[model samples]
Target: MTEERNSLKEFFNYLRHHDLKMETVPLKEQKDYQHPDDDVDFHAYRILLLIFICGILKPTFFDNFTIYGRGKFSFYDFLIRYPFYLEKALRIKNKEDKIKDLEIKHYETEEAFSPMIRYIRGPWDHKYPDILNYMVSKNLITVHYSYFNKSQKAFCITLTDLGLETAQKIQTEEPIWTKRMEAINAIFRKDAQNQTIEMFVREHFSTLILGNAGE
Candidate 1:
């Protein structure tokens, strides 16, 4: 029994030191990390569908005096950040069983690598500007810019006829994606109607938007 115990201790010592000291190599830095949703075509198609479902307007345009005066899904501010919010919404495990399939597996994977970084206003993705530019080059959408205030400029994005047609086809062909868009739209509409968008963001996205305020 003493010999057996000594053998076990020796085995554990081997595991704790020499066995664990097998050659180590430094991990190579990935200079350009690519996310699955980094595909411009994919984002363009999704944004087209979103604009079709929600319509066009500057997201920052809000009237404080009137209650629920703006059109539904017209806020471009929310549209710009929609992908991040959509991913968050889809990742909720407690959602109804009917929409359980909307939980995209890859979104979680993408978040693992290239999670949204907080910006001045909210969470910002690096791919949005490129996707918008690609859409414009393809004539999928049109942008109109105007001055919102003395120092600020506002832009409204609308789909071209081609964009509209393409968005329609996507809506018809991708039923699951269409449902996801509807769910996101409903969430935004509820927040907008209740004038609780700020509160909702604070509650749901506090980590991303509020956690790093000091930094």
Candidate 2:
């Protein structure tokens, strides 16, 4: 009976030491794993949100004061994506000065232009069909395609009345985004009136767009 008691005591001692050590071990931080589809959906929703803001800004219609071509639409999408650049551009009073400042800053450092550089090179046009189709299905926007020939094709997009109303409602609900959109529109509206916003974007980002054309 004494031997058995000692054996039990040793077992308890072993467990006490091992269990306490195990309890003291720190746990590694767990990373949040997002699915690939989640990223796609995130960008899709971002595009939709930007389009909604466009409805409020009215810069979505830059062609003939009623519609905008796909290239022009893509340009606006780029601006909406990187609003930091837009906000900075707004600080400069003159349009030419804004373009020059942006270009200089973009070339100043690789980090400054890396994200914008990557976006300019990305397959943004490939994602357009899916987003535009979904918006059309929701009656938020309409797309018009004109194909005269391989080199003479044109694609236009315009927001629906429902889209504009929904955008206004979103602005009412989200004051932070509303202020950002208003600031963005302040810069875009000027060039949009002259139907030169796309040209402005091209000029503002010539180094990124034109310089990286081969890539």
Candidate 3:
């Protein structure tokens, strides 16, 4: 267990050194970091958005928490709202208020997913196929497919050990470790998917590099 913990610490250090730390607070709180402009932030935002979506789909620490947002998946808002708000800010859209309103409705009213998934700049960035292709190219995941499409309004993909390893590499350095041991204990103790996911989420904002619950 100690060795495993050390390995994860090393991975987090590597990612932080490479400036690839993907959490919201760390990015914003970095002293030397300059705010990214439109195009750059868009790509970054897309990546975080994917992580957030995948995080929510899993059973997480926030599953039982109540969210005050008035959105489509607001029931899932405990997991959804922060990511949506983060994306909205990163986009620097002039229609901020309108966007918020729509996001609320986006999850609430649509039996199917909102069309915004298509807002990805490239077709390759829109759904699961694209994610799988990227992961394969980067050696984070592997799959065989000629084409990809949405299913039940969610993308279907598989995770590799590499991906799982990658997720465990990230570390939390904010608000101290006051609540983390509790969160981690909950994570390891829970056999239930929904309960475990909510626990996993309390410590990490969005990194689904870990295994999926339902799969």
Candidate 4:
């Protein structure tokens, strides 16, 4: 068990450094870091997805923790809210007031890594496929192509066994994360309607991300 803990520690360190370090390594050896087909960095993907999953799996009552894609199997909800929630969960100040916490990313390499645009630059950024696709391909999640309101809402998503297992790690290993979930769940419990979650998100996150949008 002690050896395994040490290995996990090393892996986390590798994630923080390896990708950027790859760019600086000898030009002749850069190819070693490149995968044959996948362009997405699985290392960084893990970190980003961890945050995404934490948001998806965050606090809710009766354990109803699913993201609906508004009549399609899309990343709409996750893209718009997860980043905002995760940073605050980490107690990271969100200077962008955006769903994408661009303010937290401070490196040149991180700029190209926007799964979604850092802000409402335009409609195009919102239309781009969300990084959630990577999880789908990895069997971490599955998108259901059915509608709840008779095609009014076409898509939704749920975490797979793999996804749940991954979440268990964070929930067990990170105390703050456990508390964040508890906090979000508490917010939901206090609201009688429970349907006005967007309103609640706006109340807590709007001012930080939007100058006056929440107003």
TM-score of each: 0.53, 0.52, 0.25, 0.41
Q: Comparing 2 and 3 by lDDT, which wins?
A: 2
Error of 1 at 190 (Å): 8.7
TM-score ranking, high to low: 1, 2, 4, 3
RMSD of 1: 11.1
Better of 3 and 4 by lDDT: 4
After superposition, candidate 1 runs with Cα above 4 Å error: 1-36, 56-115, 146-154, 190-199, 210-215
lDDT of 2: 0.51
* Candidate 4 backbone overlaps, count: 7
Residues 1-215 of candidate 4 have per-residue lDDT tens digits of 99999999988799787763434767776665565224544432343333333334424311223445331112222322343444453343322232232333344223323443233211113432444566677766665654334324334455667766775665566554344343333333322221344444355545333234542
Q: Which tens-of-lDDT digit does each residue in 56-94 have in candidate 3?
A: 223232221111111111212222223353333223423
lDDT of all predictions, in order shown? 0.55, 0.51, 0.33, 0.41
Query: What would the per-residue lDDT of candidate 1 be over residues 143-203, giving only the tens digit for each residue?
Result: 6554433554444456777887898999898776676666665555533432254445555
> Which one wins by TM-score: 1 or 3?
1
Which is superior by lDDT, 2 or 4? 2
- Please give the distance, in angstroms, between residue 154's alpha carbon in candidate 2 and its true position after superposition: 6.0
Name the weakest run of 10 consecutive residues (lDDT summed) in model 2: 109-118
Best by lDDT: 1
lDDT of 2 by residue, 182-211 (tens): 455557752252236545655555544533
